[model samples]
Target: MTLNIVFMGTPDFAVPSLAELLSNGFNVVRVYTQPPRKSGRGQKLAKSPVHQFAELMGVPVETPESFRKPSVIDDLEALNVDVACVVAYGQILPQRALDAPKEGCLNLHGSLLPRWRGAAPIQRAIMSGDEKTGVQIIQMAKGLDTGDILLSETVPIQPTDTAGTLSERMSRTGAGLWPRALAALSRGGLTPTPQEGEPTYAHKIDKAEARLNWTRPAKTLDCHIRGLAPFPGAWCEMDGERLKIHLAEPSQGDGKPGEVLNDALLIACGDGALRLKTVQPAGKPKMSAEDFLRGTPVGKGTILT
Candidate 1:
């Protein structure tokens, strides 16, 4: 029997799984994503990445403000889907919605279960300097990520990995897993196991946390910077203006924290230093440290606040 699927997700992270599912011949009857929100300086509305991709693929899409509404849940039940595959949906599911599909709702979560069991898993993992993290297919339960693990795969977190880079790799790995999970589901071969160990929450990142604190050790600062790069970037004040760091590496040096160590963009930390590799100045596109310094020279021995 062909399983009818209803896809629920809102971001780029979900698209690959949806694509993989469709490519492998899953009957995706509908897609549910967050509604379009205002974006950019123009303040024009922008549909989520999943919404756009679902449309391009000719799949029907629904954007409900909340599933708290009975009508919303009623509409979902109307789909009569055998399964609902959710990823980064950006909304909490009520128990009713979880029970709507014939089998149950399954979530494609970013972290190994019982750890990073909340909104900012990937960023939290990198920021914590974890050498390993992985993806999981879990049976959605009533509480926050307290679900049985259905499938999983471990992946190493390389030293060079930023939140952005790691996310892309994990998404692809998850894309491959979705097909296997669904196939196993069809054959009744999946074995669900209870999650073990104490859990850690990956709380949503606040903009206040993005400010660079040079008083922290160089290695910690490096992880912090990488964890928040490319979006809500780790930033610092220099020359009385804001500078966003996209990539930085720890190096040998010593000075008062935030002091400019040399002409090559090595800035001192409490314990060591870091070379500013990729950066973006206020109102400017991202550029290399060399390019930025060529256009705007920052002298050594100057202190950054």
Candidate 2:
């Protein structure tokens, strides 16, 4: 029997799971996504990717400001959904909404919990230099991502992996995992295991954290830069202008912190040095350090604050 499912999600990361369910013939009764908000330099309203995709698939969509209202819960309850599948929905569900579905809700989380169980798991895992992370399907509860595990699949953390790359990998992994987990739930054989060990919360990344601290070890600095790449990028000042570092490599060299070691843009840190691999200057395209140095002369002892 096809189960009645309600998909809740926002952003491109959540798109695959919804697609997977539809492609596999799950009975998706409705989809919930956040209302579009004004964004961009011009502040024009932009619809979320999930909303656009749902419309294309001809599914009913809901964009309530909050689920705390009784009427919202009443509306959801009237649907008689068997389960809700949530992925990066970006809103906290009210208890009534959580309880509206008969078989409970499940979430596609981007970490191997009980670690990184909060808002910025992918960024936190990369910034903290974690060796591995994964996608997890969990039985949703009241606490933020503090849910019982339904299924998990680990992915290795490559040395060169940035938040962008890791997030992409998790998205694909989530797509593959969701259909099977939902199928098992439909079959009445899915067992959820309680999360084990102390949970480390991945607090949201502040915009201030994007400023690169050359005083840190080269390896740590590399992680910091990579983790924040492609958005609010790890930044430093050079020649009185802010420069964003998108990619870098650990190097064996030393000087005063932020001091350039050679013409290669090997900047000294507290512990070692880092060779700038790729960077984007303000109002400029991302380019290799070699090309950047060639265009703008910077040599030994030139400090990057």
TM-score of each: 0.99, 0.97
Model 2's alpha-carbon lDDT is 0.91
The alpha-carbon deviation from the true structure for residue 167 of candidate 1, after best TM-score superposition, in angstroms, is 0.6
lDDT, residue 147, model 1: 93
TM-score quality measure for candidate 2? 0.97
TM-score of 1: 0.99
Per-residue CA lDDT of candidate 1, range 1-305, in tens?
A: 68999999998889999999899899999999999999999999999999999999999999999999999999999988889999999999999999999989999999998999999999999999999999999999999999999999998999989999999999999888988898898889889999999999999999999999999999999999999976789999997999999999999999999999999899999899999999999999999999999998999998877
lDDT of 1: 0.93
**Tens digit of per-residue lDDT, candidate 2, span 9-113:** 999899999999999999999999999989887999988899999999999999988887788889999999899999999989877788889988899999999
